[model samples]
Target chain A: MATAADITHIACVVYPGYDALDLAGALEPLTMLSSNVPFQFYVVGPSLEPVTTKVNASVVKTVSPSFGQSIAPTHTYDNPPEKIDFLIIPGGMMFLDPIERQQPTIDFVKKTYPKVKYVLSVCTGSVILAQAGILDGKRATSNKACWAWVMENCPNVNWVAKARWVVDGNVWTTSGVAAGMDGMFAWITQIYGEAAATVAANVIEYDRHTDASWDPFSDAWRTTDPDHGKSVQPKFTE
Target chain B: MATAADITHIACVVYPGYDALDLAGALEPLTMLSSNVPFQFYVVGPSLEPVTTKVNASVVKTVSPSFGQSIAPTHTYDNPPEKIDFLIIPGGMMFLDPIERQQPTIDFVKKTYPKVKYVLSVCTGSVILAQAGILDGKRATSNKACWAWVMENCPNVNWVAKARWVVDGNVWTTSGVAAGMDGMFAWITQIYGEAAATVAANVIEYDRHTDASWDPFSDAWRTTDPDHGKSVQPKFTE
Candidate 1:
């Protein structure tokens, strides 16, 4: 029976080509703690219409790029919550989409960051934060598969290539899609308490990569001169 | 340019209180292969309206039970796809939800299972399959937190207690939410070949639990007599 004031409004910015797992993985832990903490989660997009998650490629002759999931946004950029305590940003094939199509979300991130108590980004989502100048000097990370492109796009940002997730002040940035789950769990432990984080992880039966500095994929992917979608190399034999 | 015949129609059943991670974790890998396979994903519910993902608790005075995420169903049980190659069933608080509210989905599963080339159940999703009689005399696994309740409800099915995921013929059942990711990757490896799965896992930066029998959470939760939502035990320190 908590009032609206007691609720921590956590909003996630989404758009077409945003990764579904990146958004779902990070937010899943927060939803687990909703009993004690009235975490009212909101998915904000450019509009109220359903936005497609990232697809590997366009379907032949289809009017729209069909994805595994289409997430419905509760709030539009024009109608976000009064205040967002925690802001999550997930990246996907956003780089491929025209910058004009991405500008609204980038603007929203910049506008929302100052008011947000904590900010987190998953995968190439740090690129959006970087584009918004939030990661200008902050330590962050992104998907190693698109490492060069993320770096090339956001030159002002300080990117860490070898960490699973990086926490600097109130901002947390995870390496890639599934790594967001680990980062969110870590955030839950720090913010909600250790017990809450433990429960969240255990309920999902998630075997987390506990060591932040020990990211193997970063090492595995770096062995080759990376291409756009060249995700794994021969070194990933394990 | 894949024709209609070249596509593999994957249909996921979503109802009220379905786990977001359970659905997302299992489907992300399949979406990664959309380029080569044209794996079209279809979310089917009782109706065309939006379906809420599982929430930890209800908000006071709210008309509708709000969750972190809501999935929009492209198809309904009344109007399903002509053919479905893969059928994914994800679980959450469906146990608490009324059987009548769940009956439609259970009925849909029973009707669709025979035609589906491959069937997957994540977490307590096995319970639905069990309810639908699809798991009759077949070996399966489910979320360890609700082990007793699931076992009691589905006495006929041979429930495996120590598997991250179990595969018997064309049917697959995962231990819990995140465990579905491992199960899906394994399915991809077996069905699509090893190279595709390797790329999918690496791209998401998911370090998989390769061994099917290597489930630590099963042992972690088994230590305590399971409560409804008793997710983790003290032995989960690692």
Candidate 2:
């Protein structure tokens, strides 16, 4: 039973080189909820400067705070909502490598996860979550193309490779770019109840794909060489 | 040379039921072209009530010297550019049937086509063009899904069934929605030159699919389709 009050604050963190759809997919679903629930959400990026996507047609802007850096009640819908209930991180091609290595950003994710109700990632964003050490012994997933790489670098995490969306408790991740939309709906279903989420999906005409739930890493991995043992793990570039 | 002066004006005609992408695709390419050429374009619909898309997320304000009303080109960008270089119609799901039967609108298109230098349609926009009898006996194309319907209704027209774009003299039509972008570049190529169009395509990173031009109604039709005898005509119930 997710009420409008339950979603007091929502923030999408965007860094330089963020993918447009990675953020857009999540934003679209959130707006559907907003259109009905009347919750306040804004594009929060590194700065006020407008950022263009890699494709270059779409433009995204940032939100600013009028109050002190930290505001009230864990989560308020004011100019600067202090309490964050949901924090979404969208991955773009440019942010792929750097964000995984960004220590300060990792610390921020680590610090914020305990406070937020749900921590979400789209596309390569799961890599960032992995580097932050949040997925240790936790079931997680990432962009399918990068799953092999994730397994080698972040061994502590159990990766679900075959899912369009992998949800384990409060941590959720999605595959590729467009799959983020699926991930958002999955999030909405949990927060707003299935009926509300289904109606929202119908309004957008997006048919939820079947491969949308979480599974363990063993059955999820797909390797080309059957002769080669499953012992071969993913490798990191740096 | 398609010099800046050659394109004194551009017209993006909007109907009561128009798709946003068609207008956008045409506008973005034209805007990109404007960097090299100076031209102005405006949105003109049947009325001025702030037309909305089928999905209703975006709203486009309409302008006029209404279609049948007398035009004083000096007053607004609503009129086709000074030379009437380009007249574009974007397609939307609303354009599927009933709106296509509007007498005054069709009459305006019928009367106006020969007067313009280049007449173009994006997606189901060819429905309007066909209904106006502009496609009669002309070699053209439209969104792939609507090809049979256009052929059945606009009998005299020779439809190209499988092309992303088709150019027949000054008349051009595109398959599907995004193809309008390619069609615009093609139109610019005809007006300016291949070189400038190539540059514009490069700016957008448009990877034009270099497939064979598909003309299902031509002599090549006999070689490809043995069952060309079957005719599945589209019925537009207005």
TM-score of chain A of 1: 0.86
lDDT (10s digit) by residue, model 1, range B29-96 = 87666655656678899888888785334422221245567788999999998988889999886545
List per-candidate RMSD values in Å: 5.0, 13.0
Please tell me which predicted candidate would have the highest DockQ against the true structure.
Answer: 1
Candidate 2 lDDT over A1-238, as tens digits, reads 2355777667766554555446645655564455456454544443433433322223211111110011011221223346678888776543234433345445666767788878889876777688878888888766544455556667888876566678887888877555676788878876777876655443333335435753222232342334213543432110
lDDT of 2: 0.55
Worst 10 residues of 2 chain B by lDDT: B63-72
Give model 1's clash tally: 0
**Which tens-of-lDDT digit does each residue in A55-125 have in candidate 1?**
43442322124556788899999989887888999988655555556789999999999987888999988
Q: In terms of lDDT, which candidate is strongest? A: 1
Q: What TM-score would every model get versus the actual structure? A: 0.89, 0.47
Task: Report the lDDT of model 1 for residue B177.
Answer: 92
